[model samples]
Target: MKLATLTLAATLVTGAAFAAEIAPSDVQFDEYGAVDQSLTGTPGNPEEGEKIMTNRGLGNCVACHEVSALDYAAFQGNVGPSLDGVADRWNEAELRGILVNAKKTYDGTVMPSYYRVDGFVRPGNAYTGKAADDSFGPLLTAQQVEDVVAFLGTLEYEE
Candidate 1:
């Protein structure tokens, strides 16, 4: 009787442990019933996308990456991963997450938060608080971000 009880208890504990290890599926629907999936189905124009990619006022992707064999633009840093085949490695949502707020997923990251709307302290003028505001504040607008995401979709590896 003691042996049977111990075996049953052990089995129950093992099963519970296995159940605890299970994780939720990646894709999830929001409160508005919109299916949150990566930017897989969107079509993009490489030329227009290239403009955004290089534009310092917009995507500014070239600031940290060497994309395309274009003209001589200076100050391209190789600090981050080379975006040669970013589309092959990450889906749209993942890219969006990186663009939106890298710090949420990775703490102590040098990457600036782009899409964060709340909890941001407003800056004072030169007399009161002379320090410059977050100069790296979002280079691209929301629509521009969507456009960039569309463009990044095209950078797939030839597999």
Candidate 2:
């Protein structure tokens, strides 16, 4: 009985620790729509970021942008500009802002705001706005957004 109780306690503590890691969804943008703050107050892992950016069930950045560093990915779309040398074009905060909400940076952009929750039309429901059963939330976690930013920062011109 003591062992079971100890295990349960450990699980709860660990779960809480992980839950606290997620950054706040209320993001603040600059005049240029750049997020100048770190979402997690810690540097993200570039390797993990790369995985999240390419994963179809996750960031799925390849669906609209082509990343030369991710040439292994198939059927990369061109709707957005190439991210080959994005690191040279934008700073870390700018990259973070773009990921958090591209529409804030470039109006009329089809990019989905990955971390925004408020100001959404008929939020807290499915995308079709017909199903109230599905609870809509930030597409990616705070840590995931930081991770993608770290990865994008590495996409400098290779030439």
Candidate 3:
């Protein structure tokens, strides 16, 4: 009986410590996880961001969501969450997590990683064994990711 009680106490204490390690707000995650950094500075231009959204060789954001206002093409995908009011829902760091690698934020996600390393399988061919490009290739450059983040910042809802 004493051993069982001690084990329970240890479990409870460990759980509490783990909980304390998390940030107070739901918006903050560690450098390796989702976080909030929207209030830091000016974001990217929506117009230039629009280009990334529609670009098939770069961001290809339309392949997973319907940013109707941004995507004029009819073949936009519907696999991921719609990006209509994402800016209102998430801050820059949060968006960065989803953009950089949605699976890091939510496991079992079909979204591919844009900036993360070692999370994907090795590719075969000319790009052979390169971490940057999966079977599809690198989604966007770091600058392009920043531009997309800036563009997403403009998607706030009118209150």
> Over all chains combined, what TM-score does candidate 2 have?
0.77
lDDT of each: 0.57, 0.83, 0.66
TM-score for all models, in order of appearance? 0.56, 0.77, 0.64
Off by over 4 Å in 2: 1-25, 122-134
Q: Candidate 3, which ten residues in sequence have the lowest lDDT sum? A: 19-28
lDDT tens digits by residue: candidate 1, 1-159: 999999999878755544431111232334332234432223444567677878787667778886554346567768766677788877766666666556555666776655544344456442332222434334444445556666777787666
lDDT of 2 by residue, 1-70 (tens): 9999999998787555444443435577999989987777667889999999899999999999999889
Misplaced by over 4 Å in model 3 are 1-32, 35-43, 123-129, 132-138
Candidate 2 vs candidate 3: the TM-score winner is 2
Q: After superposition, how far is residue 130 of candidate 3 from its true place, in Å?
A: 3.8
Model 3: per-residue Cα lDDT over 48-111, one tens digit each: 7778888887778898898756656678889988888989888778887787667767878888
